[model samples]
Target: MWHLITAPILLPMFTALLIMLPPIHYSPNRRRWVSMVSSAIQLVLVVLLLLQVQQQGQLHYAIGNWQAPFGIILVADTLSVVLVCLTSFLALGAICYGSAGEDEKGSFFHPLFQFQVMGINGAFLTGDLFNLFVFFEVLLIASYALLIHAGGKNKTKAAVHYVVLNLTGSAIFLIALAVLYGTTGTLNIADMAQKVAQLPASDLMLVKSGALMLMIVFALKAAVLPLQFWLPATYASASAPVAALFAVMTKIGVYALLRVYTTIFGSEAGALSGIAADWLLPAGLATIALGAIGVMASQDFRKLVANLVLLSVGTLVSLVALQTQQAAAAALYYTVHSTLVTAALFLIADLIANQRGKAADRLVSGRKVVQPVLLGMMFMVGALSVAGLPPLSGFVGKVMLLQSVTDPDNRLWLWSLVLLSSLVVIVGLSRAGSTLFWRISGSDTVAETAKPLQVFAVCWLLLASPLLVIFAGPLTELSLQAAAQLYDTNTAVQLILGQEVTP
Candidate 1:
């Protein structure tokens, strides 16, 4: 039962080790099966862990048999569980999509994919700042390999820029961690949260500077405004499944920001006093505006997805900036919705691009349209969902976000920006949708031959979109509870304080 708490992290790591063994390494087919089975097992473990955490409240595990303040800890609170589940689910989807063709099922792809998931889960569950840095390295290295797997000149160029930017960010992160460790004499997050407020003003200032520097690192990862230039170029050049996987990667940055700000810095009265709640609101608005403008101006479907990714980040950051419980809850819900819809959109783009290429071949050789109706319907559903139409998960999230921040008079400016951004997203999606599915020139005799498994996986996700909305009540409640866990750390402090004083 206790091991279930660590299963999310352990499962993928164990799977990676197994796949790397000599026997599995010898057979590509066996390796693919091993990868799929391992990811399926990981998905199940994540579900079981979520159920256990729901029943038990919070779960913690000590590494190397040492207790907190003395050794490493992995905490499985609601926020961590939500993120773990999201990562595992996305990994499973990407694995399924990657298993289809010869290029996708190559020997090198699955191991890196497994390692990426392990890194994401480890980062979410880790209770030490240094451990988080280690996990980030694991994830980034895998991503670099996956991004350049196609081995084109463009992908190579993009991967180099991506690697350099992320490495620079990693260096900044290490420096901040060193400053933090020197100031607090501890690396455990929970322990640092406890001591942050008691530090002298000078030391506290140093800590805040470190916090701000760490924020910049995460901002680069999250693709927030000025730091977001690399994302469009890099993601646009990656393969579709790889791009979809990268969607979940940005959430790691948002997760870190929410965790560090609310749990570590927000707990410090002086620090909270120094930074006003609405301080980031204007910057978030600026990000949203920039992303919207970029999307409208972009011509490629891949670049459009990149811009949409930025827009989602801006939306989440703006909600976080609002700093209300309701706003936090809305942000949580929106993040989940955005992750799913964006991934689906990328997969749909892949299908569209593949079909277009096939159509071009058919035109050159004069053949029939290959599964036009199926492609058309998939396109319509994905486009509308991304555009935030009603009866879809996107609509539910957008409505909640709008409802959460209804300050009629003074917030008119904010509402206008939100509305304008939504409209821009609609236009961007519509143009891409029309061009990809409807307006593309093709023959009527083309044969539809996409892998049945891939089509089934895509359909499963499409069906799940509405189901997410249908189950939105319970999921929303869970998100609200998770948000409470993040914003209300005083409960743990009170529990600790009520215990007998120890030397």
Candidate 2:
């Protein structure tokens, strides 16, 4: 159990290697089965890790048992443990779905998928800035390959854009790392936090520049405001399971932002405190508006789902900018809800495309689906959930977010934009759903049906939202506990700095 911290990262890595055996001539089913087993193993590991964090407080594992500032380490706090568990659950759903013939489109899909999981888990667990960059690169490379897995001209073109944009962002990330190391003489996050706390107002500007650059890089990955242009085209054009898996990717940026700020540049820091919140508010509002516009203007379902993903990011960023512990907890809650919802929506898009034949998820009517009643119901639930309607996790998350923003300075503005955005989301989804489902012109042609496995995959994701709602009390309590830990950075600093602290 003490060695289980490595399980989440290593399981997927070893599975990926096994998947790449050239002489095995792995069949599609075999690959899917392997991926499923690997993901199940990861899911169990992460769940146990989450329990360890809760019971043991925080768990640390250093590579090769090298101590302190020299060796690589993995830290699992409440926040990171939650994220890893969510990532593995979604990966499992994606593996189950991808196995339904989509993985057959590219020979390397399963291996890349496993690598992608490894990267995501590593990113969440890494204790140093440099390792975070390495994990980012690993995930980005796998995503690039996965995007073009089915081999479409449009997808290839979009993958090119994705690669180019991320490469540029990576360069910026490296520059920021160099600047921070030059200024503070450390890349370990807790070490840097100590240095930043001691940094004077006069000497802080250089480090501030580096922090801003880090923010920009994260924003690019999060698709925040102006940096978001690359996501829709890339995600919308990709295969369904690939797109579904990418759903968790943006949340990684949000996680990085929260992690870095709380540990290094948060309220505990002198000049860097409130820096991100100051800018994130306006930019996040703008992003919500931008995503709403994209949703309305979208001609197809894939693009619409992509826009919804962006909108969710904006919502969380804006709430995060409120800069309170409750806000942080609310953001965490919504992050889980939105990730599950986004993944389900993406899978639904692909499922609906099959049943619609030439209608193919377009706004226009072409043919009726064999399972319109079921699919339509699922879409409505997703839409209502995303729009923050009642009796769902989204509604609970939104209410908590609103409650968290009781700061008299910005409560009205927060309420106004959030409500207005919800209205836009509802109207836009209503129009699109009616157009896609109600205006169907009947065709005599038999519609192609989605695989039973694919349907199960979608159902798995769809049910998570309701489960979140069912367990909202415990989940909210957990998120609040996680938020308290983040705000209580001293305990984290002690652990990360290798001081003798209780587990």
Candidate 3:
């Protein structure tokens, strides 16, 4: 069963290949079934893997039996598995929603979706920096295609910006890898962590530069500060399911920052300890302020939600920058909450757009939707949740984040920024909700009712908000355990280096 560690990465890959073959590729129904079944199976595998990690600590797999610091290695710790599981769950909702004719809009949608999933799971599981880079490219390539899957002028424009920016990030990622490899003499993360601790004074500056360069790439991915301009247009214009899947894409960068910094440049590494620490807090605050403003200014509902993604990124980065185990746990909880809510909102936006005729998600007065109460209720739930209102998972997450900050300065900055931003978000969303639902034009035509499958997918993801609140106990415990595992860099290095970890 240890080999199941490879299943998350391998399942989607083989599924994609299978999907690209003659019958499945040509037949939309067949392709949809194949993709849906594959995603469901992947989710099951991920749950089993998560359970195994909870019971077994961390699981390690070496490609071709080559150990760490030599050949490819994959490690499934609590943190990595939790992320992989999230990706799988989100992917399932996306594909299920897409099955209602969204997948038929382009060639190879199912295959690309599978490959995207493959890349995300691989990124989460890989134990080497270069492999992580490879996985990044894989996901980006798949996303480039999916972004323009429905083939619109807006999508094309957004795709161009998305592609160019990510290609630049990829170049930076490569350069960082080269510098780190040259400095540490290995790409294996655990090995590099050990090497970073022993580096000479001369190479210290070079390693530091590489590490900082790495943070830039991750910050861009996380949509932080000046690097965040790409996300709003890109996410707002993509097809709904594609946009939903892209929600987790940003978290990859956050995951990288947390993993790489906490391990390689951790406190044990002299002079380079907490290299990105000073930069994270200020950048996070700026990002929050910017995102809140964007949410208020957005004319399009989808764009507003896109900006909410940015706000969540800012909240997460700020929490992670605290570098406490409690903060990490809170960030993880928020990660799950924010990703699910944002994705659900995107789907809801698409549903509303379909119902609003030509006004179509523009946050303008338009014809009443075919199903006002259902869509309105969903929008309200998503908006309240996104704004971090109480009695929901979003509220729980933000409260956890707020409670985790013990330092007076941090508390002042975090509480003020998060609260003010949440207020801005609420005001923005309230305007949007009222405009879309209440200020309707007296038009005779109504859009086709939402498909059952699409509604089901939206409901499935939206359920996460309440369910997260109800199950906050287990989930928060899991997050805390994951956080603890992440901060135990010494044990991680030892385990990856093939040494026994003593209790």
Q: Largest TM-score belongs to which candidate?
A: 3
In terms of lDDT, the poorest run of 10 residues in model 1 is 494-503
Predicted candidate 3 versus true structure: per-residue lDDT over 1-503, tens digit per residue = 88999999999999999988987777888988999999999999999999999898988899999988798999999999999989998999999999998988888888899999999999999999999999999999999999999799999999999999999999999999999988889999888888898888999999999999999999998999989999999999999999999999999999999988888887777789899989999999999999999999999999999999999999888887888899999999999999999999999999999988899999888988889999988998888888899888989999999999999999999999999998999899999998998888877484688898998899889899999999999999999999999888778888889553222
Per residue, candidate 1 scores C-alpha lDDT tens digits across 85-117 of 887777777777777763343347877888888
Q: Which pairs clash in model 3?
A: none
| lDDT of candidate model 2 versus the reference | 0.87
**Candidate 3 overall Cα lDDT vs. reference?**
0.91
Taking all chains together, each candidate's TM-score versus the true structure is: 0.93, 0.97, 0.98
Candidate with top lDDT is 3
Candidate 3 Cα misplacement greater than 4 A, ranges: 499-503
Q: Between candidates 1 and 3, which one is better according to TM-score? A: 3
Model 2 misplacement above 4 A = 22-25, 200-202, 499-503
lDDT of each: 0.76, 0.87, 0.91
Q: What C-alpha lDDT, on a 0 to 100 scale, does residue 360 get in candidate 2? A: 88
